[model samples]
Target chain A: MKFLAEINVMPQKEILDPQGKAVKIGLQNLGINQVSDARIGKHIQLQLEAGSEAEANQIVTDACKKLLANIIMEEFEFKLIQL
Target chain B: MKFLAEINVMPQKEILDPQGKAVKIGLQNLGINQVSDARIGKHIQLQLEAGSEAEANQIVTDACKKLLANIIMEEFEFKLIQL
Candidate 1:
């Protein structure tokens, strides 16, 4: 079975995102005024082959902990689609 | 028109990615040895409303510069789909 995983990695809410803040300020300069909040983050797509959905979930979990996200300063969430 | 953009942001070739290196070593430990290289990065999906393909492209470009990517250490590429 093949699975497609969409993962989002973002700085913990308590942690300051200087990059995001900088971008938000820049957006204000660009005259797009409706935006009030800007949070910057990363999105990851993973394609994995597994025997079952359970196995695929395990793989994605491992990938997230060990590779895709920084556990110290970041938090991640994912949704899996069987393809 | 609506467009779906898949954006990949990666470290510049000149930059050293300690995270990616750690992942490569960890994968080798998992007994799945076919993997020789690991590069860690981000994927972003954008849902945009536009009047035409050309306008959509411009919006994407602006978004990339202003929000979606870090031009200093990262690079991005996107594909647009009409919906």
Candidate 2:
């Protein structure tokens, strides 16, 4: 089975997102007002072949902990769709 | 219109990916070898009510340039889906 994983990695809540902040400031200059709290992060799609949904979930979980995300500074969640 | 934007923000080609490199080394330690060149990034899904695909595309492009992406360090691509 093929699975599509979407992952997001951002600074922790207590941590400041300087990149996001800078972009927010830039947006202000662009005349797009009413925008607040702009946070910047990453997204990834993984096409993986697995035996079953359970197996795919396990693989993704392991991948997140082992490779895909930095738990210290990032948080991740994924939706599995068999293709 | 609903648009699914898959974005990747990595160190420029000339820049090194220390985070990805560390993950690569860690994956080796997990005994699931044969993986090389592990690059990490971000994916975002946007549910927008647009008049048409063209308008949606324009919104996405502008969003990327103005907010969703950092042209200096990131690259982005998106797909449009009417929902």
Candidate 3:
């Protein structure tokens, strides 16, 4: 089976997201003052082969935990769709 | 009313994403051979105030077009939710 995974890795609440803060300021400068807060993260799309749905889930989870996300400062979640 | 926007900015299909390529290689080195392709992009979460849903959409769209995304090399989309 073939699968597609859409993964998101976001900084933990306690961590400071300087890039996001910069973006917020930039938006404000552009006169979009309605914005109050902003956070930036990574969005990853993966195409893979797997034998079963469970196997696919395991692969994506392992990928995120082992390499895609820095669990110490970030958290990750993913949605897998069979193709 | 306050709204939250989830935005994604992705490299155009013709663009080469070096970071994504590096990640794919890293995954391969880690013995995750199932993955065939990977692409990386940005995920932004914004908290803002707006008068209506349409107004919120306009704000998010303007933000993406003006600052959050580089329209020439990237494409962006966002979902707005009432808060």
Best by lDDT: 3
**Model 1: share of native contacts present?**
0.10
Runs with alpha carbons beyond 4 Å of true place in candidate 2: B1-29, B32-40, B43-61, B70-83
Per-prediction TM-score: 0.58, 0.60, 0.97
Question: In TM-score terms, which candidate is top?
Answer: 3
- Order of all candidates by TM-score, from best down to worst? 3, 2, 1
Considering only chain B, report the TM-score of model 2. Answer: 0.82
Clashing residue pairs in candidate 2 (N, C-alpha, C atoms within 3 angstroms):
A42-B42, A43-B42, A43-B43, B1-B50
lDDT of 2 by residue, B24-45 (tens): 6776788544434555665444
Worst 10 residues of 3 chain A by lDDT: A74-83
What's the candidate order when arranged by decreasing lDDT? 3, 1, 2
How many steric overlaps are in each model, in order?
Answer: 1, 4, 0
DockQ result, candidate 2: 0.22
The residue pairs that clash in candidate 1, if any, are A43-B43
Scored against the true structure, residue B45 in model 1 reaches a CA lDDT of 52
Candidates 1 and 3 compared by TM-score, better number: 3
